[model samples]
Target: MRQGRDNGFQAPLWRAIAVYRIAALTYATILVVRNVAHYQRPVLAWPVVAVMLAWTVFTTYAYANPVRRRPPLLIADLLLTAAALAASVPVVGRQALEEGKPTLAVAWHVAPVLAWAVAGGRRAGITGALLMGATDLIVRAHRDQAALTGSVLMLLAAIAVGYLVRIAEVAQERLQRAIELEAATRERERLARDIHDSVLQVLALVKRRGAGLDGEAGELARLAGEQEAKLRSLVAARSVPADGDDGTDLMTLLSRQESPNVTISGPAEPVRLPPGTAREIAAAVAAALDNVERHCDPGTRVYILVEDAPDEVVVTVRDDGCGIETDRLSQAQAQGRLGVAQSIRGRIEDLGGTVAIVSAPGQGTEVEMTVTRLT
Candidate 1:
């Protein structure tokens, strides 16, 4: 069985197991001392008890270290505890056991079952519990309600501990994600302040001075003003609450680009992805559109189709514009103009996705991107 990461998140659980071991050991020792006179071999019983004491002390310290809580340690603990429990057949005669004499290990054997559950989760813990429980039953010469009840109780305890550990690990993951979101929010606020103080102020001044100017100067001012407004909106940032629990929806971001010339089509339901992943996909889509806008004539219609499947997402961006010549893309890369390479392919490939661009001299161009869903 594979062990969980050796983090201190489960330190309290380990400590509780250690405390339980010591307490169970003490109780078992008291029982043996009180019934020593009735045992088949009194001298042999003392050595078995001594072995249990030594093992109890060793495991109390060994299990405290996360690194040592692996299969080798857990397996050895279960086997050794089972051996001690089985030793009762010889130390205390079968007749004495049938007369209701307690086993040599008594309640001390359940410690390893809990250790298994904590280290390898429910399945591993249940395995240990069943093995120990069988050993407990075999040690008894007589069968009764009390004997059966002890095994059932140990199995139930193991299941409960396993579930608790799983819940704690999930809670830890959510807390870590929250910390990252808080840090991102703080960074956005700082950048917004800096942009408002400098870049936004300069753009506002440029617009005010060039508002009355004619020809090229007025046109430049208008473009600058448009960029400023877009920048402001970008800095404002989106509220997490508005995007639902799965970050920003890819469909929501792409649908915003729709216009008379740009037609968007996708599933009626939202296509959600992780926040960072959704942003990268949207940016890649934007880059593809920008390519079409730069090379195509005004109002040359474009079609965007989104396909959301169980295992993957497929987005196709096609434009009814002047397609590229065979060597144009390679030439652009050689000239250090990497708009397609960096913005389109780079973004998708970084996310473990793939992009395919098809074009011809007179035919329209098509860019298909596939991003696999992360489980």
Candidate 2:
């Protein structure tokens, strides 16, 4: 992927490279014209400089579009630049090069190294630098400080540009994340305001009015009160602090499902899983709990168990409720109720995991999800 922001420092860097190429081309052309008299093949030097000028113009437009900046184009740039440098050997003549006269390419060869650095990072930049530098040195046919200076500078430029590219990518990623977080925060606040004005008020009223009644009336009141508290907690809950790029602690999320009627058990230490995987598992568990809440009697017991292993993680949500016939599930799917299939089964399967649901009439439902971790 192109490493830069929508409005970032990296975009300007490419333009800078193009500008450098143009300036270097001009410098090289001037040197070739001025020193033509000293050249062994004076007529040949102009053609080499002309090719460099054409390439400079080509790359200026080609690299401006990000879609054209791929490995194939980068490879072509590096090889063609090396070829231009090699052309110096015959055009400038070996003896003149030995006498310290500048090659036909001169500063123009470094442009490809900068392009590699911007596109592929430090290692790729270094590779390009070494190849071009070696070509320059071999074409010059000498090994002195004067011959090595350009190569060393190219290496340094590659390293610097590659490092800066990495930093720019990180900065852009963080900036995008910050913008998303701000938008999410605003939406959450608006939703909270609406819930407070409507749902919470209605729930509180039901709890108060129906509390003194008997049988299902009181039970309904208790459920409403419980839902009100859960909704408040849901809206007010803070996100768990991320544990670097490794993953999120799965136990922390599962523990959040704990309630007066629900029990969660897991390893004492943190059970770390990839963030997306952990959240999907937690959501599946939540879906199981929801099924228990909607279908089972009030105060039905739900137990969540998490098992962490080297190659896999398993989460089981078992509820001691009035279980249904297995055929009922198929019937429900056919009738368009897909909470169990989509939320619980589909989520685990999408992550390359397995979901085994075991339930029978008069027996409780047990949802066992096993996700194998990619080492």
Candidate 3:
């Protein structure tokens, strides 16, 4: 980020730099204009002219360049500050010698410290203080009545401002990071819901119908179902990267809180399922029962069982109803009807598991899905 030269300790670093550059130029222009009557006095005019030119060039560079150019910019800042301080010493010296008392040189000391705070960052501000202090000492060293106490107090204040400027820079960076994270999380959730409702749902239906049929037609439905489940899982696990990506996870991004009707049965022990296994298993079971609820009897009794073992976790859902004929499902698939083929079988296989269907005429359908956890 780039900002102009207004180096207020509280504002963002870039804006401070931009403000500093403009203020420095304005100060230089005003100094020259106000001292127009002193043009003939080369002793005073020449140094002011030199300092004005140096401050303009340095402030311009600091404002234009980013943090990548900080090294070179920092070096130039130090040089410009040194020149400004050197110019101030002679001007201050002439004042003390003529007036016999030290007077405030606003352009010489105060403006330079403000410029350091804006364009040069913390180190630059400290450098300005040291130079300002040195210039005060130079004029005071010659006299027994130099105000050492006031000069030291002003130098310490400049150092304190430098540390405050650093704190402000850190705070700005953190705020930007937090905003980016919030936006990404919201986008991920939206994608998940869309995929789950439309794409994954179609795939699940295809798998279920395929399982209902027998022979070659049933096999085809099974293949289509497996593909859909994998796609859904992939969509649920994705994340957006720093470079800005529209990424999403299938389960989390797609599935909503709209609870599915599921019946689970198994041992009391927690099943050690694979990464995507448990969620997909639950989805497949829910999809199956949905089909049973819609196609079979409204009061159909469905049973779910979870078997936990050392190698695998098996989930079985059984429903009592008339079994499906193999031939009718093929004709349905040809017409692109995927209700049973994609939804159930495809989901189970995607989790590195198997879907077992057992049915014969009046002997109701039973689906046994087994997922093996690799750890």
Best by the lDDT measure: 1
TM-scores, all candidates, are 0.74, 0.74, 0.42
lDDT of 1 at 228: 72
Worst 10 contiguous positions by lDDT, candidate 3 = 242-251
lDDT of 2 by residue, 195-256 (tens): 99999999999999999999999989998988887787677754443343568888878766
lDDT for every model?
Answer: 0.86, 0.86, 0.57
The positional error of residue 365 in candidate 3, measured at the CA in angstroms, is 32
Q: How many residue pairs clash in each candidate?
A: 0, 0, 46
Residue lDDT tens for model 3, 1-375: 123433243345445554655565567556555654433343674566566666656555544444433445545555555555455445545544344333223333444554464455556666666776666566444434445655666566666666666677667666666677778778767887898898788878888877889988887776667567556655654353322222222223222211223334555433434435556666787787776767675345677776777787777778886666556556867899765567777887776778877776667788888877666
Report the candidate with higher lDDT, 1 versus 2. Answer: 1
Worst 10 residues of 1 by lDDT: 236-245
Candidate 1 lDDT score at position 287: 94
The deviation in Å at residue 223 for candidate 1 is 3.7
**Error in Å for residue 358 of model 2:** 18
The true-versus-predicted C-alpha distance at residue 239 of model 3, in Å, is: 8.7
* Clashing residue pairs for model 2: none
The order of the candidates by TM-score, greatest first, is 2, 1, 3
Task: List candidate 2 stretches off by more than 4 Å.
Answer: 1-8, 240-244, 255-272, 276-297, 300-375
